[model samples]
Target chain A: MEQPILSIQNATKIFGGGFLSSSKPIVALDRFSLDVYESQSKIITIAGESGSGKTTLANMILGFTPCTEGKITFNGIDLNQMNGEQRSFYRQEVQAIFQDPYEVYNPFFRVAHIFDMITRHFKLARSKKEAQELIEEALNLVGMRGGEILEKYPHQLSGGQRQRVMVARAYMLRPKLIVADEPVSAVDASLRAMILDIMLRLRDTRHISFLYITHDLSTAYQISDLMYVLFQGTTVERGNTAKIIEDPRHPYVQELIDSIPVPNPKIKWNMNIKLPSEEVMRMKNTVGCRFYPRCPKRMDACTKAFPPMVKVSEEHEVACYLYQ
Target chain B: MAANEKILEVLDLHVQYFTPRGAVKAANAVNLYVKAGEIVGLVGESGCGKTTVAMAILQMVQPPGRIVKGEIRINGHNIVNLSEAELRKVRWRELALIPQGAMNSLNPVLRIREQMGDAIQAHEAISARDLKARVLSLLNDVGLPERVYNMYPHELSGGMKQRVCIAMAVALNPAIIIADEPTSALDVVVQRVVAQTLLDVKKRLGVSMIMIGHDMGLQAQMVDRVAVMYAGNMVEVGPVESIFAQPLHPYTQLLIESIPSIRERKPLKVTEGLTHDLRNPPTGCCFQFRCPRVEPRCLQAQPAMIEAGPEHLVSCIHYQAR
Candidate 1:
């Protein structure tokens, strides 16, 4: 079998268990694993609500934070053990697009400054003319023109335009994977489709895989080929995006899918549905299923110990006592 | 008092922000109304004047951004020209507002009881004991627990904080509630829960509401009627089902088509072209620059709202000719 491009095995990230601190260590992510192959580019969605550790997973993968347990390897090289040259290569191979496009930019600099910094740091271009050509090419790939946006300051461009420029900046690196954290959450609906379409185009044409992290399931459903539904940092369900959305196996996944208000008025949500209080939902359950407090079909065994991932179908897996 | 009676109405409303540059027309001749028990959704892209219209309806347009010309009639009373003292009498008692990002709207330093108490006492001279009863009942109406009364805003979750805002909005039992994206900040499950809380509260109180948001899916599920805005102009208004089923205006159509659906996957429909500058809007249609079915006549003069179907209004040259 061919090696995967990126592989995460039993990754665990716990924060704030310092020597002097009295607060309990918060398990932001626990026992999460995923594999992305280089042969086929895909948009893999890591979806969960805020504080559900989706961002923590993204941070771990981007090397912004270190995992307390397990290992993450890129092209057979462990991220934690990478040397100086390998670290720079990994940086060039993996680029990121953040949630707030406005905050990512220096308000004082022109939009072109972002691309220029990337070119100088990565040594992608030798001369000014070569750098200009590269920037234009990257912009054109994202369906934007360099002439209109390059000279303008970050404040001058709209949210959608700024996001597209970020995409173009990531594309200029010619990275294998783009970690986009809620790229379109701040953009409007009309322009949101444009950004998501760019992700799809990049996957199909350029073979640039994407780790699309978002809380928005609708857009994730529209673009992601694969999905991992996280519940308070634990992988409740991992499978094909369409199949999981259509027939969500885990109880948390079921609730999450039911919560999305359908666009058609004919299909209204059942108004009688009630959710448990946030306090109960956020209670630390070290040994039991994290969703046991809120799960509708929870059993006594669910509280005894955490359930392992059980194969639901050929390509789908769910971690639930009910499935077991 | 009767259902379907117009409880709140905005007639030819114009809100302008006078910056160093020419006046930025925020809401231009925008017309909207809310019936006694209906939820009218005001939706548009950012900077398209959804929030401006909400602020104008509340008579809270800030300095440098004045209500240039219009009448905001609440319960058949034109409060547009009312003095601050006179407006205060009508503000919360008749027209309550659940402002945008309502999670952060709550005072972190105050308990939920104190904050809600402030809202109630500001409008009514209620006894302390009675205020406690009213606040608890208001919390119950929004499906919040009684324990939340003693908890501070920071202790509660985003969804709970939003429900607290909803409870406060109904504290005065106002004739109308303007919820500006009440569930925009929460997660999907939590957003649904908050949305359901809003619906339950509305059903119980029978208060007319104007829901301002950009989530088309949410608007489809919650609102009785939908109003589409473009560059500060109300382009289309119709029944919720009709607006989703057969959106008339080019911009409205584009807005609906752009919604990403969960049931199926298809090529996204992208709307190109930038919104015209608000400081100097085009003489003709506000959406003419981005309208897919643009005609030469559309650039000649601004199209007036014409009835395209039963109670459906559209401002477009194509609809006008029809």
Candidate 2:
């Protein structure tokens, strides 16, 4: 049976505060919802271009930005209702691997400080000796050997090695879920595959769930089990990764997929979707479709009323007027 | 002196960077030839010394980076030993550079037209009217609308800005254009469009080009020949089909397998170890550590480029003489 590990409901995140805040809230996430199941919890890649609300949704999952409107419940513990201790416990279970591996570690601190972090917070090991053992085990899990790696500084390591170190740091806690934000973008092209392979192996061996966040759709399609298509802060499509990629239904989804460089040099593909107009910017205040301005098959009512998520099959759901 | 056939012939070029760590040899005795009107693709991963080789030929190395050995002959002139005064004549009118991350390439405060006009006027003694006409024509050739010339850099999209940069590069109609990572950041559709424009411009102007990029797949599309780089060294150089279809270097083979192609659905076989460190690059074969087919002798000495086949050169000792 498919068992859901976490279920997000009607989540909304609006950034900024005080007098500088604009009249219309910058809707980073608009009433988004999705269910992540344990059986197929290998990786759920949330990918989009910059300002596509991919990072905002990732922050909501990480508990960094509390959703303004709705709830994110992890194993039935409502994230909003949780107190400080409970939140910290939630963090231990759901670790975050942010982009820019250089920024993840403090420059002044030693590499061993990472182990100290897991020790001071989660009490991840049985004793000091056990903790050292665990750190070594985690380092080896990400394909880095123990003796040579831990003593080196982040600057001393290559981009790929440093990224792998971050993965190792996350492995130290054996967290059930990891929210990795563009983890491989900083690394070189050759090393990106190595890091991705490690993550996949971890999912199979350790039964860990991952919320892999990225803007590179090709890499996302390579790894993700389930995927979401977010455009300008709203979920346009969500379904099985293979199905959505093989035959994208939404116009935006099709466009994003078509934009990827294929190996074949002969075929020229333009998704043929036009950019949103000035009128669409004015219609940002409308109640209905956020993608109304750019949608190819848009109707009058689509601008007046928000479309509901229509189920295409048991595993697919699309939020578009055409589908509805 | 005619510029009739040969544009540049780089013979046994070697560049080394003297860091506090050690002397890292960037361009490990590379040799290449560019015809008067042809495109050669220099393909590799980032930090593979592709940029180092390009900069060394341009004589733009700062401290800690130097071209220790070899020759860079451009149009029968030894560029390696050219004085600063002699090289100034070749800057735009002879060969121009279209570097990566064009967002930083353009001047922010200046209008697009002014920036482009400045390049043309600096190189040629043309009237303002003639310069304007040339700038507008160049913009049209690169597929940018005439309005784009009037707008500032902030007003344009990434693709538009890159197109403008291309226009600026071709303003003087140089004999050779070294376009480094020209379409890496662009979306696939936009990348194709930009790449097509570049090819079209190169064809029309009859200018040779050195197109440098990080992926073998991307390079295969536009370039006639491909040169693979790894940790400041050229590992393989051959025709594009040979590089992709029958790669001689084990590293090149691994790279081909790793890219997610339209045909292959299986997860790519990622190279296990990280790239070689630039500061303390290993002796002998830089890729000796992670090579799946590494032999005992590979650890001891670097292999010279050997004839793998017709027009194919490889630097793997395993394929060389016993």
Best by TM-score: 1
- In candidate 1, what are the lDDT values of residues B184-250, reduced to their tens digit? 8798888988998899889988988999999998998999999999999999999999999999998
Report the C-alpha displacement of residue A59, candidate 1, in angstroms.
0.9
Return the TM-score for each candidate structure.
Answer: 0.98, 0.89
Task: Please give, for residues A1-324, the per-residue lDDT of candidate 2 as tens digits.
Answer: 655668899898876653886566677888888787766647987866666688888888887778888989987889878888888878878888878888877877778888788777787767888888888888888777767867777787777888888888887777888889888877776788888888898899987888888777777778878888787788878888877888777777776676665644454444243354334444574477776776667788787877777887766778777776
TM (chain A), candidate 1 = 0.97
lDDT of 1 at A167: 94
How high a TM-score does candidate 2 get? Answer: 0.89
Position B180, candidate 1: lDDT: 94
Stretches of model 1 off by over 4 angstroms after superposition? none
Cα misplacement distance, residue A181 of candidate 1 (Å)? 0.5
lDDT of 1 by residue, A1-324 (tens): 989889999999999988998998999999889998988999999999998899999999999998899999999999999999999999999999999989999999999889889999999998999999999999998789999999999999999999999999999899999999999999988889889999999999999999999998888888899999998889989989998988899988888888888888988888777787766877788899999888888899998889999999978999998878
